[model samples]
Target: MREFMVELTTAVPEGTDPAEVDRRRAAEAVRAGELAEQGRLFRLWRPVGEVRSVGIWRADDESDLRSNVLGSLPLWPWMTAAVTPLQPHPNDPGPTG
Candidate 1:
């Protein structure tokens, strides 16, 4: 598996119904939990005062990350994401250190 750092930002379309946005948010939370349980989603965070999020994700490859993971996001249509693959450093101390 490969790890990726994903940065995402969401925008609620102007003039959209607030209730509908709320509903989407609820669904997003549910999907997030499911992904976490499946071990695809490693960690998530929100940038303070910004409509942005960061996630550490594990996937078999970039295609899986794009299709099964990002594509499956409920709010994907309204979001923009940047993905960066991570590689381990040889000299860094690991858990055993």
Candidate 2:
């Protein structure tokens, strides 16, 4: 698997129903959990006071990440994601014991 750093920003369109937004948000959370359990989602963080998140994700490739993983999100239509492929550094300490 390949790793990627993904930053996502969400913007609900104007005039959208509040109930619909709530429903999608809930579904998004569920989907996120599934991805996490599958080991595709590694870590996530939200910047203070921002409607955005940064996360580390794993996938077979960029195409798989975009299509199967990211495109599956319920809020994907309203989300803008920036994906950066990650490479291991020789000086990296690796995982903690």
Candidate 3:
């Protein structure tokens, strides 16, 4: 498997309905949890006061991560994502103890 750091910048159009934005955000959170349970998403964080987010992801390859993971994001249409592949570190904790 490969690990990647994905940075996301959200862009909710100014005229979009607030209720729809809220709905999409809530749905996005639910989908994120599902990805976590599937082992595709490892960690997620939001930058302080920024319209951006970061997530650590695992997949067989970049294509898999893009198609199966990123592609399935609920808020994908309103977000721009940059992905960087990560290398395993010797001192890093393994998947399990």
Candidate 4:
């Protein structure tokens, strides 16, 4: 199988706040079902950036990725998110341990 990099940017769905309750709820959902089966969550930090969270994902393909997001994340139906397919590069630095 091939490897890919997925960048998922999530918005705190309207009344949701990324700092307090929302993050906790999300973390719960991650623990309850998602993280074990589908995602590795390579990066999650709040030091400083354009986005609040950043994760590096590994999957079999696009469909697998979708199955993961829709199945795991407790995001609202109207929540906004973006997923990008990263190109493979010998020198890409990519996601590291």
Candidate 5:
């Protein structure tokens, strides 16, 4: 598996119903949990006062990450993501280190 740093920014379109937004957000949470359980999603964080998130994710490759993992998100239609492939550095301490 390859790891990536993903930054996601969400923008709900104007005139969208609040209830619909709430529903999708709920679904998105559930999907995120599933990914985490599958060991594909490592960590997620939201910046202060921003409707954006940064996370660490894993997949077979960028194609798999985009077509399967990210495309499955409920809020994908409203989200814009930037993905950066991660590489281990010799001096860096890993997860267990």
Candidate 6:
């Protein structure tokens, strides 16, 4: 049970909204029952790409993170996105007393 940060760079094709596409991807991932299983996905951030759409997946492991992303890539949206591995952060969101 390791924590990781999964970075996603989304490139929506012409006549597409990166935000919308990303939302759709999220929904599909949820429907497929992969997002949560992959990890907690504590937080998500964006506004870091050409189209201003990036995501930070708070995943548990590499495989789970990859599977979550793959579950809804080009299928959910007619666009291309890269789910890259980012260095894990030192801080862990552990239970606080």
Alpha-carbon TM-score of each model against the true structure: 0.89, 0.94, 0.87, 0.51, 0.94, 0.41
Off by over 4 Å in 1: 95-97
Q: Superposing every Cα of model 6 onto the true structure, what RMSD results?
A: 5.7
**Of models 3 and 4, which has the larger lDDT?**
3
User: Candidate 3's residue-wise lDDT over 15-78, tens digit each?
Assistant: 9999999999999989999999999999999889887999899999999988889989888888
Model 4 regions lying over 4 Å from their true place:
1-29, 32-39, 45-51, 76-78, 92-97
Say which candidate scores most in TM-score.
2
On lDDT, the candidate that comes out on top is 2
Q: Which is the better candidate, 3 or 6, if ranked by TM-score?
A: 3
Off by over 4 Å in 3: 91-97
For model 5, the superposed segments whose C-alpha errors exceed 4 Å read: none
lDDT of each: 0.91, 0.97, 0.91, 0.52, 0.95, 0.54
Backbone clashes under 3 angstroms, per model: 0, 0, 0, 0, 0, 0
1-97: candidate 4 lDDT, tens digit per residue = 3234444445555665557656656665665355535444433444376653445555667676567643456552434435666767789885576
Error of 3 at 27 (Å): 0.6
Q: Model 2, 59: alpha-carbon shift in Å?
A: 0.7
Question: What is candidate 6's lDDT per residue for 7-67, written digit by digit as tens?
Answer: 4444456887778777776775665355556555545556634443445565456676566
The positional error of residue 61 in candidate 5, measured at the CA in angstroms, is 1.0
Per-residue lDDT for 1-97 in model 1, tens only? Answer: 8999999899889998999999989999999999999999989999888779999998999899989898898898998889999999898696663
Which tens-of-lDDT digit does each residue in 3-96 have in candidate 5?
Answer: 9999999999999999999999999999999999999999999999988999999999999998899989999999899999999999977677
Query: Which residue pairs show collisions in model 6?
Result: none
Candidate 2 deviant stretches above 4 angstroms: none
TM value for model 4? 0.51
Clashing pairs in 5: none
